[model samples]
Target: MLCIEDLLTLELFKTLPRNRLDWICDRSQILNLSTDEILVSEGDPARGFFIMLSGRMGLTRRSDGMEMPIGQHEAPSFFGEIPILTGDPNPVTVRALTDCHLYQLSSEDFLTLLHECRNFEQVIFKTVAKRSRGLESFIRNREKMAALGTLAAGLAHELNNPAAALVRALRDITPALLELQRMNLVYGQHQVDAEHTAQWIKARDEGYETITHKRIDPMKLSDREDELLDWLEDYGVEDAWKLAGPLAEGGTAIATLEELTARWQDDQTKMGTMGLRWLALSFEVMSMISSGLRGAERIAELVQSMKSYSHLDQGARQLVDIHEGLEDTLRLFSYKIKNGVEIRRSYSPDIPKIWAYGSELNQVWTNLIDNAIDAMNEKGILEIVTTPYSDRIEVQITDSGSGIPQEIKSRIFEPFFTTKAVGKGSGLGLEVVRRIVEIRHQGSITVDSQPGKTQFTICLPIG
Candidate 1:
């Protein structure tokens, strides 16, 4: 339960009208959280204010592979105070380090109360000062980390081409080895006896000739064996004595060296591709991956998709087909969706291309569809319908899952506003999506909701 004193102590509301303050306190609720429970997290939009009623609360920040503790507010203190003071997206995460009881004030009601009173402005100013210090520290640290991230990302991008080539090269090796193996068998069959092998040799050569004519000799087997052995040694094949007789008898032994070399070459290509991918991601988001488990490719890809979707590097917009951007984003998120969801796609034929930002638009689609899949827990129906809207195209993304609450529908577009569990969402996703659509693309997105039915309709001018 919220007490009048809690609202009374905060500087932001010191000047609020007594009646409005009373109204806010009356409406506020006390939420008791168990140990390790999250109260609020980074990227969740500023709701109102979270004041610690009792117990301890901790703020954690991710910096350079370390989870550094930022600030801990004990009972009678407030957290997420900065967002309420600044009315911006909350950048720091607040969690209950121990069992805690917190009084959550509605941003709307709190602001209404603040406006009605003038006596407490001084107190509000003081509290804002306290919270601002902590926020400044968090930002300073984050910016520094982001810088290191840029250098690393550039390095990753520079390495991508080689890696891509390696993966591509490996893909072609399977067929090459198969062709070589067939040649080996033909040579082995002719190795049995010289006179008896002549007819077999002629037939084998003719067969090989018909298929681009590669020659092999059963008698020249000695030379081939020497060549094969040298190649194997180069490939680290140490157990040659035992491998020799069978290989000589079957003529297919040389294929192992080829297979090993192919795999090795392929691995090089794959690893190189990863670096290039990270580099590409950095180009989009500009060092968003300086922190987190980037050693794991998931974080890298997340950074990549985020960067691509943001279009941070360029503000310019051009004509784009939302469907194309949507498809590209889907490829990025397919792994996550595949875990349990059966995706249903319904793209309209000849989806008119609209003027838009190619990458940022990708993010909007990615965030929306990703959320839909999550809403369904990766199962249930997800339909993306596109129809011509005279001068624009309208997209209706509906899912068979829990729908948004009517009360929170408006808040969903607010920056950092989220309804997901801690670590599961930044709450900034939809906020960013809406930003790109409305502000950047000069488009509109609306939502309608009911049980198991929520539709996000986006309209973008095609001309």
Candidate 2:
């Protein structure tokens, strides 16, 4: 049974007059719970206000398909007010951590008392604000972590192909060089004729040019390989097919091979086909070096893009080039954007750098671009245009995809308001974007949407 002493144990109840305290005692119902028992679950309808007389309760919220502990409630505490006041479902689940006794007041009775006592209402609203801020803070951190995880995964995916190519090139180049060195030593033992050697060197240099410059037409390469194969076989070279493709890729003419090999044909040593073998191997080695260099360059490019996107070397606030930031983001998101999404850019080269929070401003871009990609279902044309003025710059990101409904357009920026399925969104992405733009940077962002086209326009002062 509820008593006056139990009511007085909480400072909040002490704010009420004696008659109101007696009224609470009469109206509140006694409830007992064992350890691990649930008091209320997340998303449950607002039942009433709860006053914990004894024991502790844990508060957890669901995020990304997992239950995360947000807070706890101890004995001599009160809760269940936020949902009741807002007339919304509970945002967290409260479960008893130990055997407990609690008093629950019906929603109507709690509201009646709330209106009757100004001091109590004041205290309740203040607590509500503090708790709301705490929850928001926790959620915002989780959102940042989730975003970071996504970028890291994309970076890894983008790095894989080039890294593998580099490894294969390094692995294959060593043996080819050793074989070429053996061929050169054997050829040095023969009678040295300056004119004949010059012919072979000239042929080698021309082939090197063809391979490095990719001068051979890919369509003609197969037919050329067949012609080389027929000549190599007639010239009695073993595994003639192996050398044919590289020889053809090097733009080797069958007539040139005949002229170069004419003297070696009469010789009865490995030198008979050694000159032809040397030319093909030389071309293959050059191709390998070119491929390896390109792969290394690609790796460097991706690393630099990620570093610039993060603004890791810069201070919190700095002069930022809008186009550079946008380009860096697109590079990082290339894995997502390349799957049938076409990007159209109309950047104003004259737009001046703006003094702003560099990393936070990038976050604004991240959220908006990420959302645009999702809205398009990863297959659409995304258009970005920048307009520069003397005092301000405007960026418009437009996507060809399903647009926001007219009725929900106004509430899209509200915190905790989202159209994404549960676990797919925290509902604070655009809200955070709004805060960074309007509140932090003193800029403004607006969205215009209709079926098949949605555009978000952001205006920021250049200072």
Candidate 3:
């Protein structure tokens, strides 16, 4: 049974006159809920306005495949107004935490009261605004954290291969250098002729040049390996195949090996094939050093790209090269893009750097590129084009994917609006993009879409 005393417990009900209070008491139905019982679920239709009289309830929203607690409601609290007012589905689930009693007012009756009482309507609208801001704030923070997690994971993946190569280079080079020192000691003991030693030195230097420069044609490398292998076997070297690859990669000729090893053939000591072993080992070391250097350079490149993309060292607003920002974003997303996406870039060579919020602009690029990749399901052509004008610059990102539907195109930039499945999107991505471009940078954005192509164009002031 409903009573005037129960309605008065809430301050909001106190705003109404006696007759209106009586009206609410007559129209509101008593609803009892057991602990853990759901009153309304996220995405459920607007049921009505609810006035909590006793006990507590929990509010949770689905995000990233998990139910996240956004807030709680205690006794003498009121809710269920946001959805009713907005005429939208409930954005969160409400579940009783303890046995509870509440009054559910039909939408029609709530609206009638809202229109009839100015004070009641004022209070309700204020509460609605506060709650909306709170929910938006929580979800926006979650969105930023989620985006950071994704980029961190991608960075780890991209760093792995080169880091491993670097470790292997450091690990293996030490043993090979020690072995080469021992070989040199043995060769020095022989006190071979100066002319003979000069020939070996000349051959080793030439091989180093060839390996470092990558002078050998890959197509011809296999044939060279075969020739070296056959010559080493004929000369009685054990495991001749092991030495062939290094020798061929160094662009070693059969004649050079013959000339260098001609004097050592008759010597029964390790000196017999020492010349051949020395040359192969030397070439292998050179190859390792080259590979290690390349890996280090790649690591440095990725690190620099990330640093530039973040604009950590720069001020909030700086002269930003739009192409650099785009390139950095593409580099970060390379793991996703390389799998199946083809990127086509066209930038006006004369486009000048513009004063803007550099990092925020990068975020705009990140969200758009990320959405473009997903829209293509990781397999399609992503085209980026930049055109410079006297006063402003226009950047376009186009993807070959199923286009945005015509009906929802206008609402695409609205906050909390999304076509992505639940838990797959926060629905704030485009909203953030819009804010950064239009509000923060005083830029404009527009989208054009069709069956196979969707392009988002952003125009920003150069000054």
Which 10 consecutive residues of model 1 have the lowest summed lDDT? 284-293
Q: Lowest summed-lDDT stretch of 10 residues in model 3?
A: 263-272
Tens-digit per-residue lDDT, 75-165, candidate 2: 9999999989988677788999898899999999999999989999998999999998898888788888877877888889999988988
**lDDT digits (tens) for residues 136-177 of candidate 3:** 888888878877777777888898888888889889999999
Candidate 1 vs 2: which has more TM-score = 2
What digit string (tens of lDDT, one per residue) describes model 1 on residues 138-178? 54445334433532453355335445544554554455455
Cα lDDT, all candidates: 0.60, 0.89, 0.90
Which stretches of model 1 miss by more than 4 angstroms? Answer: 1-315
Pairs with backbone N, CA or C atoms under 3 Å apart (clashes), candidate 2: none
> Weakest 10 consecutive residues, lDDT, candidate 2?
415-424
